[model samples]
Target chain A: MSKPVSKFYLGVDIGSLTTKVVMVDEESRIIARATGRTGFSGREVASRLAASLLIELQLSEKDVAATVATGYGRVTFPADREMSEITCQARGIYQLFNKAETVIDIGGQDSKVIKVLPGGKVSDFTMNDKCAAGTGRFLEVMAGALEVDVKELGGLAEEASDSCSISSICTVFAESEVISHIAAGRTKPDIVAGVCNSVAARVAALTARTGLAPDVVFTGGVARNKGVVNALAAQLGTRLLIPDEPEITAALGAALFARDIAPKNKPCV
Target chain B: MAEQRRYRPLASTRQLEKTMTRYYALTRYHRLWGRPLRRPLAWVTSGAPVELLLAFNIHPVYPENYGAICGTRKVSAKLCKVAEAAGYSQDLCSYARSHIGSIMRPDLAPMGGLPRPDLLVACNNICGTVLKWYEALARIFNVPLLVLDTPYLPGEVTGHAVGYVHEQLKEMAADLEKITGRRFDARGLEKRLLLSKETISLWREIREFCRAEPSPLNAPDLFIHMAPIVVLRGTKQSLKYYRQLRDEVKHRVDQGLGAVENEKIRLVWDNIAIWYRLFAFFKDFSQRGACFVTDTYSGGWAVELSPGDPLESLASTYTEIFLNRSLEFRARQMIDLIKDFNAHGFVMHSNRSCKPYSLVQEVIRRQVMRETGVPGLMVEADMADSRVFANEPVKNRVQAFIETLEA
Candidate 1:
């Protein structure tokens, strides 16, 4: 059904809220990519996604020379090696934009600011593990509070005439702030814009903890939201270089690592 | 998973367990013989001057150490909840919360809660929380609470600061004399101070053994083995335990054995051990060939006794602990440990309970990294509370930190 493949690499990133899988050729070309909601079990979802993804390319698991897993569920997923999302993000960003000196990744439950050394090594990183204030989960809660779809938040925010102040960085507290804003007759566009600006402000503080260096790359699910992208850019006073597919960059990076480790396993030609 | 995970524990843990068990057992049943022996048990903070308690023949018990026991036993959440339900805010120190919860509900605490105290000594050297915590204890027990106000030293330990603490010591000694019906003798404290000095020196020597290429001991070893040092610091039992520990550590260093199976990377640890997940947490590092060669926490007990007579030295020693020092001193301490231990990196636990230790850690981490040119990572968690430690998230951070170090 498809061209015969000699060697291919697989990468799986089973994050908290989503599962992504990518297949790459010997030249690191992305052969196929798939993503899903990662519902109950990331491991099962990852395995199923990989199975269906392989069939789409008419490739079997045997064609995969190596596998590397990265993310919250990476340890449970069967792979040749497990890497941290930070390392994989840096790798993916470096490969796409070689000049990226900093990476700000806002995932489902946590946000991180990574300082990348030459060649994509993570020289320093600071993550907000204490709370979910500056993450996608925070946005999800705010959207639910406003009775708006999370995807529509960006479009709605772009129409705001005035930005209502969401004073609290706490998800629960900020939800109340949004309710008060709604009760005070604030517009939906204004409230949604305030929510995005709040996330940007929280993330901006994290960058201060780890000094922001330029040619910055923003990755992860939240990077898909253009509202946050614009707000974060304005907050940090720098332009962000976003990949074509932000959510799958970590999976691509893991696949790149799988490529690097492929030669040690049988011939990766 | 049903089978419990076993670690390569130090050879001296048997002695450590025996010493600690006996100490707890004795403290547990102190009500049986304490009054008859005229040795009133005094509940004290971790940084309290215990040698003076010994001089007065007063048995001292540590609630902070018992909080650690509750944490390691995995009952801190149950205990802490009891305290929180009783109006103690969840924001309070987990140690204080769990300990106070034990007071409200001893059935949930280890050793059925520390033996009831006849007096309480609250020292502010370690943290300001102890003052309020001990005052509450005094209220609950209706015992005479002795407060030792150690001035915060933004720089070196000043004569004025030491004098201020020395006056509180005199007042404390007088209070002890009235309670124990005995005269306070500066000369009588000599033997206790000597034993404490010798035990601390032995601990220092044992820590120095970790300077070896493949560190003979990891931070967990130091944490587990330092129990006697905390509870039985100024006694023959503690002295005996450290002697065994020192020799075993020396033997490992001589034979080129490492606590971590493959010690490829060496790290210096900051802050208290995550007691509830101690083994499970450190295993993440050790399995990755990262051995915590040294740490700032257990070494808190190994501080040198200041040069002075017993009282003056006690004033300075207790006042100058790492937790009491300035940010510059703390950053310098980490930098020195990194250099002296030849560590690849350092990790600071942004402990939710320890405000003093965790507050300035970011600044200190930045300073340490700048001075040493090595990366430092901070993990957010509570030392004793399980509710705050998100397992998957913590694992993610540790894995990333280990990868950075490996690269």
Candidate 2:
């Protein structure tokens, strides 16, 4: 008799700027993944990524048992189910670390601090309100002003002997501050470090409002910035558990949910 | 953006608009009729003793209501900026800021701003901000400002607190007598108080009708219909309006009509309504089968009048409002609402303009969740300023909350 073919579940996170897809088998192990820019058409990007991921995994569309979509652009992407990034992030981090008490997710346009209770449920949460001052967009803007790639910001900041202080709490005003710093002949690395510090400070305030707890997990595109990671660690006064692929954490969580919600299992409402 | 479709507006909205337009017209053209009718216009806070002012035959105009009108007209941001330019901090209450801005530039205001007040009545039962706001108005308008300070009740209303408020009411009566050149008539005051009590009872009944399955009224309906209750509290007009509203709501309940099409999740709202996006904001929830059956903001006027001396009762009734109490009291009040309304969850607006109402909300959320075992969602936005609303984040949070409830 032939062995049974393994069933795979798909999860897609169509964020404002990026679309991520992850495929996990019945055992909840990620088997394939893909990421792409979500431009103005998140549904198109999600479908293209999903097709590419299926090809890379040598699977047909029918091979996927279930699919779940998450993030800001979730509603645009058709899936078997839709979930919010808050729940997906909490679920993903808890699955990876098994002890994640707090999660500080800094996305492209927003930041959120979620308190994770036992069993991967969100106990409480708070998001950055109506501003992009402490998010990945902030870093991208500062990088553009400093004439450096966003990925280079962390390394450059790490090389700085001292960091400048960014006093403005607003993104637009802070960009002006950066321009003034550049005009005043401040070191690029120092200015970059200052930007990182400001982002960390803003995120720390958000986490504090949600009552930050131990075993903090950092996720999202901003988690890749080493300078921000270091500054956030210092501000929070604790180490962070960053997933191997920070950007795919929410997608992985969605896949996990899909696995549990496949045809044989009772469906999630 | 997709083509925005207007939801079905309340039937009472036409009547409300007509009544309010006539009222405003009367105030605008008061000079033509004031001398013969012997009516004076006084600007009163939402929590002020409007019944007493009515007894003195003074036309009571509510700045807060006009602030809401400005909010609905979507001019609050511009008005608020004007106030900010005039040196008021942006952190101050947006309603106060917008109202002040309207006064400074009446040409830019709706209806050339509320007609000038002969007297300003400020009550601190709602928030201390009113005292400062009315004081600023008094300074600018140069009118007498009567402050009725209602001490914050950490627990139940105390005799000392009631006594203090009673003394102020007496002094206010004397002041009204001096302004109107008439003796303070206890009979008139009692009659007005009785009418106010009946009006409050009718308002309460209208809100209670929301407890019906597939609630007869939504948050905005309650908000719109409560206008008369706020501005015409001691009049036959308010009682008449609420009676019509109560019957309409009762008929909706009988016919098994819901505020939202398929009302699956009933929610209790905390804090003030986002007046700028009232219909659009609630559309997102209603589309998902979630309905806001009741809210703490408009329900502030639904309390039963304490049985005692008229002034003493007014003192206790106004001072014991939900906003004037401690966080514990507010939490319990929310819990009772959730239970009484049979709500599946609650949504709290962490409003930026109203600090007293927004602050301590996290604590209250925790307490209510612990007591009720139902989830609570917090959306941080300004009540009046659309600039402070983050659409995607709020959508994500609300969607996630509804998902949790569904699970």
Model 2: residues with Cα > 4 Å off, grouped in runs:
A1-8, A39-44, A59-67, A78-81, A117-119, A156-167, A173-194, A213-215, A234-239, A257-269, B1-18, B85-87, B104-108, B251-257
lDDT of each: 0.91, 0.87
DockQ of all candidates, in order?
Answer: 0.82, 0.49
Number of backbone collisions per candidate, in order?
0, 0
Structure candidate 1, residue pairs in collision:
none
Candidate 1 Cα outliers beyond 4 Å, as residue runs: A1-5, A264-269, B1-7
lDDT of 2 by residue, B313-347 (tens): 88888888888899889999999999999999999
lDDT of 1 by residue, A1-269 (tens): 54554788899999989999999888888889999988889999999999998889887677788999998889899999999999998888888888999999999987999999989899999888678899999999999999999999999989999999989878999999999999999999999999999999999999998898889999998998988999999999999998889999899999999999886547422
User: Candidate 2, which CAPRI tier?
Assistant: medium
DockQ of 1: 0.82
